[model samples]
Target: MKQIQRFFLVSLTALLLTVFTGTWPTIFKAVARSSNPVYVAQSLNDLAPILQQLPTSVRDRLTTFISGDELYRQGDAEGAAAFYRQVKPDFEVSDTQILEPIYEAEALSPESLADWQQAQLALDDDDEAGAIEALQSLVDREPAFIPAPVQLAELLMEEDEEDEAIAVLEEAATLHPYSTEIIMAQVETLADEKEYLEASIAAREFALLNLDHPQAPEFQALADEYFEKFSKRRRRRSIFGAIGNLAAGILTGDRVPWESWNSAVETAELVELMLASESEFGASLAAEYREQLPLVEDPDVVDYVTQLGLEVAQLMGRDFDYEFYVVQDSVMNAFALPGGKIFVNSGLILGANSQAELAGVLAHEAAHSVLSHGIQSFFRDDMLSQFADEVPLGEFATGLLSLQYSRNQERQADILGTRVLATAGYAADGLRNFMATLVAMTESAPPEYLSSHPNSESRVAYLEEMIQRNGYNRYALEGVDKHLAIQAKLS
Candidate 1:
């Protein structure tokens, strides 16, 4: 037992000697086996001097780089730029040699080029701050390289680091105002960020200065268009300031006002009580029963609706491929979907007498598409989803009593469509006459679908008033069925 104890003491002494002598391979292997607090505390104490020796600027740069990298990785480009620029580099080891006295002696060597290439690689890897730091090092070594600042500015712009990008570009532009590409890029960025007024001023300045250049004419034309659009938008906003407040609750992200919510409830209750429930569709049935629905594939029928659609769009001053689809349902309906998709029910077609009358209804729905009214109307209602079992149907169909667009919205579309149809070389008579026919139908055989879009005697008269004022409109719409070659054989 005494021999065993002596042998253990000798082995313990040897281990302590190995640890104290800094033979870390053996010590570390042993440490890999246990958590020893004394060694950890001693190790940290030894690092204190090393930590103190690091330059404050280098420390700051490292901290900032790490934090900014986190932000950049998270897709917060603007935020990352903010953190990155806080770095104040401390590189006291730079050469004491001044280049002014010995220009070629101090000119950038291949080593400097290698550094530039390194920065470029970091940029290519999507590490903007890393690239900036690398490029900045090259810039410090060779202070006159134009590529460094310009490239940094461009990368910053792409990352939406607008303010920082602008600061860099502005300085570069001061030196090279003739670079149209750089100037235009900055202007585009400003415009996309909704700094339109500033962009317009910059565009005007560029246009005026470059008037003698070949591209100046193009720039001037674009500047003039921007000026006109912004000018008109400003005037419109000024005119509708009061109306903006009244309806803004529904248009913006703010909470819906109590008054608006109450109005919605009241309107819904009114619709629930008074709206027809698909029972008032007899006139539509008669119109369809007397005449077999015109085939959608009928060349004459397609040609007729397309011509009217084009005529209507022209009047509205919108350039769109106007199309009319025959849904074939004997429902008194017409709808405008996104991207000029217009559907007119065969029932609405047979219900009308004159080609002009049918043209009016088609034109009105076309106006809805052009003015984006249908999209806006959708945003205002039906933001709900309900289903029963596997089938989907509304408890109350929407068309029966849509609170007809506010009279103002209706009047706006009417005046706009009237002008469009008249300008497109189509007679406004179709629009007016159709409204009048609908009025007559309203009195004689009111279709359930017509309730929400109740015929206004005043509206038909209003179209006539516009025609008399605009003076017997004369425009012709030209359309050809480019798809007639593709109609599948029907039995």
Candidate 2:
């Protein structure tokens, strides 16, 4: 068994290397003939990072090569032939490096290219109807021609046919699941229609589809934004549902079950409900997390941490009870679980320079809970359940390591966290300073902050904007001596 596993690993590695070094046709054939083609496809897709880091010309050539293979698989023999013939003459490939100047290669066949160019010309001429007709015809002829569907969908939107546009994009997504443009259009259109649940799901699927793409971080940020918006909508619905349940109970002369609403459920209450067969999900999972994660033992330290968290929560006008735990780990990390369970790593606490700094971090985690990030994490439509079940925990961990908040959610957190810090009588600079430090930390070692957060520069800039726009006091609270005392306890 061990030998077989070792052989599989070696073969997969070789196949991945061939995907980079060999000609397009050879790599395509190899992937097509593989026992587990999906695995082969993913392994090659992992080359996105390396492909992105290459020179622009090289990346373009690689894209052309892949496009050629895609055309071939779609039965466009002439297009495939053109790409194959052009590869060697345009550039000399020596040891996986392009050795000479290369002419631009065609990713589309001559015939299709001419049609697509004509459609573009029509659109430029303010001939929306003509552009739509041409692009629609082009897509009808070649459903796999990704550009046609994207253009057609855009033109459809211009004609105030958003539903039809979404349909066109959806079909294109099915055919060209890896087409970034198509997936993006579908998600944006869904969002524009306030179909946030569908938009969030689409964004997440796109992120998973192109996990290593150069724009993957952007995709994740989009997903986070969608999920956050969906959560807000869900919260509103839950509030209404609770109200309805209350009215129904009064009329029926029965006790209202407030927990029946789709609001966040407390772990203890959920466990009891499950024991009584009143909950759908197992309470054991929640208990497992609470029991397995190591917690700080010192009463004074725990009390102080809880006090600080409550102060921030109160500042945000959150009336619900919040539980804060200090995890006895060395990683500079913190996270919020469902139902207001927030965990702060001891390392994070020790590394803080001031109470305000610590407060900023705490406030940010609180925002995740407040924003319903944990709830969104488990949300699945029937379409996604099968895919979700197939993914291994280890594979899932990679996505989580980048941190789960979308770019929008992160921005919201940064904005709200700054407000919470200021409202709680702390300097607003605390979060900004922490983010700046994190940006630097990313260069030396992977910190927990980066694990599920967006790129630091954007985060820091937006945070600074919020602080300046709000005119929050940057030098309000230091609590340096008090922070040092907390550090002393841990030391």
Candidate 3:
């Protein structure tokens, strides 16, 4: 008996060694066919020592299968399905019984199942509002249940609550980042609303996240088609905007505010004002403003901000000589002038938790300069007319400070800034996270920054969606240590 047992132990050890060395077919089949499959599945962790011996691809598939099996046993059929689908190509078990969970319907609790049924009943009765409310409640309680939010968003869309519907889908996407169904629903909704840019982004994201999916090529093609549509639409809007601005300027008798301002101070003169000479109109204005405001003269702090700003500005496709200055104010605020002159408040630098956050602000301000938003605002508002025949430097500076961007312009800057941030290799979510910080900071009263740059929950949601859709590297360099050092210097 002892000799027989020793032989059996030796055989088992050899079998495990073979399995670890890429000879897993036989053992896998045996495990699948075992009468006590649950026991075998639960004991998968015991093979952890040998798992590392397998190739990374094979190891990952095996681990994914194990995770799916665990979820299946825990009655999370939908969750298990997602995992199983990912590894289905690799794990082809011959035993039907072993793979039963993959094909099983999702198991919901009694309360959830009843609620789902009630929602269906409401839909059948033509009570759309009731159905939507029920579905909303279901999703609120069981966010992981993927179907509820999708159906709820559809209902909300039918109700003409397009923004709210998009918000719902965005929240669902956040909960199930890997759910192809959820992403598809989001894309379709956005397309229905003619939000071609966002739709194209969503479709491209699906392709990126599910590279091996058979439909990836189809989605990629769809993304291109939508982007083409978006481009055409943008061109049309630009022409219309130009015509509208012309008519407005003619009617208001301020036909060339921006052109006049530009002629007053050439771009080169503005650069000189920011860099070397203090005799130019813009430079002298900047000097006067410095006298009124507390300016940070710390060379290290100023150089750090300037270099970081340059890094982001370089990728903005603009040839402007971008310059950054630090202010000693304690208000969380930053702004950009007509040229590439960006001012950063020390309070903003201190408030930022990481270098990425500060970089986000710089990128946003640079985008404003690149997009010529300030000039456009000045033109549209006929800001120059508010001044005398010769606009005083102080009044001009004050006008620049008081420039308020429209919601559309702010969104444009946000989108461009996020792209620049990601391209510059900072965490892509830097701006989104900064917005979240601002939201938290606004519990008492809105900050000075929020006054100029609007803050809303939806803005943060859309930013997150953009980041996820574009597959931007949010885990890239955050520069926390460097940020802390700078903060300490300011302190």
Q: What global local distance difference test value does model 2 have?
A: 0.59
Write one digit per residue (lDDT tens) for candidate 1, span 1-491: 77455544534533443233211001111222222212211122322332232234332333443454445446665675566445311112323321221123235578777777788788789888888777657655664455655666666777778887766555544333445665576566656665554455445445544456787766666555654554454445433532444366567745366654544444443222221211122222223322543546665456656776665565553445555667566566776543355667656665443344566677677666554444334334532212111111132233312434544345545665565555554335656555654565465477544664554666765555556644644222211011111111010
TM-score on alpha carbons, each prediction = 0.35, 0.46, 0.46
Q: Give the TM-score of candidate 2.
A: 0.46
Q: Write the per-residue lDDT of candidate 2 for residues 1-491, one digit (tens) a residue.
A: 77455545544533443344232111222222333322112222544433343334444555555555555556665675476445423222223111121112255567666677778899789999888887887777666666677778877887999888888887776545556777898889889877775676566655643446888778778877876676566556544544565565556755435532322233223323322321122223334445767889887788878998888866543334577889898788887754456778888886565577789988888776655454455442222233321332233323332336665556546666777788776667677767765665566586876777768766666666556655776645444434544554664
lDDT against the true structure, each candidate: 0.47, 0.59, 0.65
Off by over 4 Å in 3: 1-288
Per-model RMSD to reference: 35.6, 20.9, 20.5
Residue-by-residue lDDT tens digits, candidate 3, 1-491: 77455544544643543343222111222222223332211424544533444345455655665565556556675676576556332222222211101111156666776778889999999999999988888777667677888889999999999998988987776555457778789888988998786676566655644556888887778777876676566555544544555556556877576654443344323323332321233345556677778889987789889999999988765456677889998888998874577889988887675567789989988877765566556545766557633355666788778889876567667777888898887767778767766776576677789998885556776777777666776655555444544654575
lDDT, residue 465, model 3? 70
Candidate 2: lDDT of 286?
Answer: 32
- The candidate scoring highest on lDDT is 3
**Pairs in steric clash, model 3:** none
